[model samples]
Target chain A: MASNAGVAQSRALPGPVRFITSSIGAKVVMAVSGFVLVGFVLVHMIGNLQIFLGPEAINRYGNFLQGLGELLWVFRLGLLAALIAHVASAARLVILNQSARPINYSHNDYVQVKFAARTMPISGIVVLAFIIFHLAHFTGGKVQPELFHFQDELGQHDIYAMVTLGFQNWFISGFYIVANALLALHLSHGVSSMFQTLGVTAPAWRPLTHALGPVIGTIIFIGNVGIPLACSLGLVAIPAGAM
Target chain B: MHLTLHVWRQKSANDKGRLVQYEVDNISSDMSFLEMLDVFNESLIAKGEEPVAFDHDCREGICGACSLVINGIPHGPDEGTTVCQLHMRRFKDGDTIYIEPWRAKAFPVIRDLIVDRTAFDRIQQAGGFITINTGGAPDANALPIAKTEADLAMDAAACIGCGACVAACPNASAMLFVGAKVSQFLHLPQGHPERARRVKAMVEQMDAEGFGNCTNHYECMAACPKEIDVRVIAELNLEFMKAKISGRE
Candidate 1:
């Protein structure tokens, strides 16, 4: 063995390479970006709560955002960049993973909820679609006339009125509720996994991590869903000429 | 405690296998998991039925010969313990245990729960060994190594080639096993000479072996009887990239 080691050592030559090196760098990138995204979600949840302040208060908040103009464009660009990085890293990780073993599970002995864990990619894609549609309607200014009543207020589109009008439709509101529920499930796994990827959570802390995922996810779910549910119930009034 | 095992039974690689359940009552919980299986095998022999076949040699959990996905988890539910070392006490009495071989295209079922892990052997053969001739060598301590490096190398060397990591991974990726093997040698002064060549050859061998790429699910680490850290995989990746760029500098 010693002699073999020596001979092997005497002739060092280079080998083939791949784009992403495996030194936890990819996982680290995914985890760090995931963390930033999580923070954005929290901030978004807080900002969305302005809906409860009545149309005038909420519209003022929307106008305040629009007033930023170029600053708002920069912020949007930054968010877009972060989203691209997060997605690219995730895809890279998955691809690298796929290259290792393509065929799996000749015979699956019933592991509980096996399909759910296995369908993470499918769930993620659906959630991605939901995000796109939501942003298109709310931020992209592509709200369907039937879905919302876009109104001019203080030289800007009244986003608060649009949100209220949008939620007034049973179809739109129902879609948001369903999408939020899916988001909750996605976050349930994603949150706990982020900690594991970062190597922060210990085994003892796993139970807490598992429990915390659902709790935080449920809050986000309720916060997002609470809006449309309130509007549908007439607790928030629709603007007179809107919709 | 007594146990009823529904183990897969097959005469040969081409034979169709099915779950053949057997009851072994009043078994001692202190008996190792393999010992329990042995008791059942002995009973089958007396009944003129073929004994349940599984792979195992060293009951000490180091040989990596024992590769069974017990229940849902690989190597039973216990963490960081091989099937041979696992005791019957881990299961409750009257429990209907499901025993299956490592299910992967690369690892063909040789007989019952015994898979022909020659694929792993082939992957190892592709680049596992250093091409050094047997001869006289300098003193053992001629090349000094940091204690930390030695310790880490030892950790990587702990892999027994059991293929449990492959079985547990969702994608059936053998990155952990390949990574462990690569890291074990790369960390030492003896391996530095052929570091780049080793990575290139081993990686090619790994791809050629029909193993899947790692998806970062970390199930391999959890199922690993040796608890070999997934971080070693990262080290392997780094080494491979550096070798490709520097050309063995």
Candidate 2:
């Protein structure tokens, strides 16, 4: 077990992954990749918000993205690689911790750790699934027909219109809102924490994290949620009977 | 005041352990928590029952030896106070207090309320000290240190090496403990000579000792007897990274 102050006793067990996951070296890699992913998420959310410009604006945005074609695919693939690495490392660490204590502990009754730390995995998985569904329905064009009913003034199906319409549904909007809230919480801790994990959080840099973490999180949340808000408000035209 | 006690009673390290309930009557609210424990132990000795063997040396709270998981807290519920200094007034009369040893795989139970904390010593041995011979004693202020730097170092040094941070951590991570030690040395000139080596060796030792990786829970700081901040852990991480990049062995 890693020696901690006060805890003279430790039950940490050894494994190859355990060593890697616990080391300062590997944690740096995780932190760097996680930060990269946060950047990517911010950029992606910004791109998604172009739907607020209406069908022509939104489709043109998609076409411009499709304009890059292979380059965009490259970016997607890179993001996928980073996401996989982050998730894999986190899973490995979680599993190692679970195994370290073979027996179920009858711990003291009060909860000690922060709710964010305790719920990271569960929240991560939820956000992961949300992202997959979001990509499939909005970006991948795999489920385009479902959203095609929301044609714009140009007689083109506006993805932005579909987004606003999507949020009009209370159930869908509620899920989106909840997921975005969780996303903000995740980003708030994740961004600041990644810097520390990378060992870059000096006294000078510490204040930056405290300020930037919440700011970046708020911006992404606003950008992502803005689409549904516009749709629900009828600022964008959704075709009759569009879900 | 009366308090219900749920104490861990084990015959030995190898015995099956369980919590046995008891009550201590007319306990004074001003009494430090450990003093109350002393009273209970006296009762146990009178009954010919084995007294709960806990590790404590300096009741004044600087020894870093008084470790207990009280009411699911590392050192009772108060922030920035050791178990030895935790007063009964924080707890209400008739409060049910559950106490146990710090639970970690590496920290095996030696007896009731005591565990083998030698793992910390082993990690320290790995490289907590600066290999320097400044002679018996240097001038009181021979080397200059910035007031801010000195204060920060002292703040980190305030970490009594009490294991409350580890016990408070869900994953039982030792990052705070190692980080505080690393930061204290890194903050001063004397520590500069062995900075890189110290970080690398201590972190390697910490990992080898089988502690879980920190996930930024910050519970360690919350439960810290000295309220040692998590920033020290951040400093330690910074030191560790620089050491690795600079190829310090």
lDDT of each: 0.73, 0.76
Superposition error at A166 for model 2 (Å): 5.5
Docking class of 1: incorrect
The DockQ assigned to candidate 2 is 0.34
Instruction: Report the CA-based lDDT of candidate 2 relative to the real structure.
Output: 0.76
Lowest lDDT 10-residue stretch of candidate 1 chain A: A13-22
Q: What is the lDDT of residue A198 in candidate 1?
A: 54
DockQ of each: 0.17, 0.34
Per-residue lDDT of model 2, residues B189-239, tens digit only: 989988888887787777666677788878888889898888888888888
What's the residue-level lDDT of A226 in candidate 2?
A: 68
Model 1: CA > 4 A from native: A1-119, A139-143, A147-149, A184-243, B25-30, B129-136, B139-142, B193-197, B200-204, B237-249
lDDT of 1 by residue, B1-249 (tens): 867777877789888777777778768888998988888788889899878888889888889999888875789888899999899888888887888888665677899889878776766775676667788997888889999889888998999999988888876778788889888887787777777777766665555455555545678888889999876776776676567567663
Candidate 1 deviation (Cα RMSD)? 6.9
Interface alpha-carbon RMSD, every candidate: 7.8, 5.4
State each candidate's clash count.
11, 20
Relative to the true structure, candidate 2 reaches a TM of 0.87
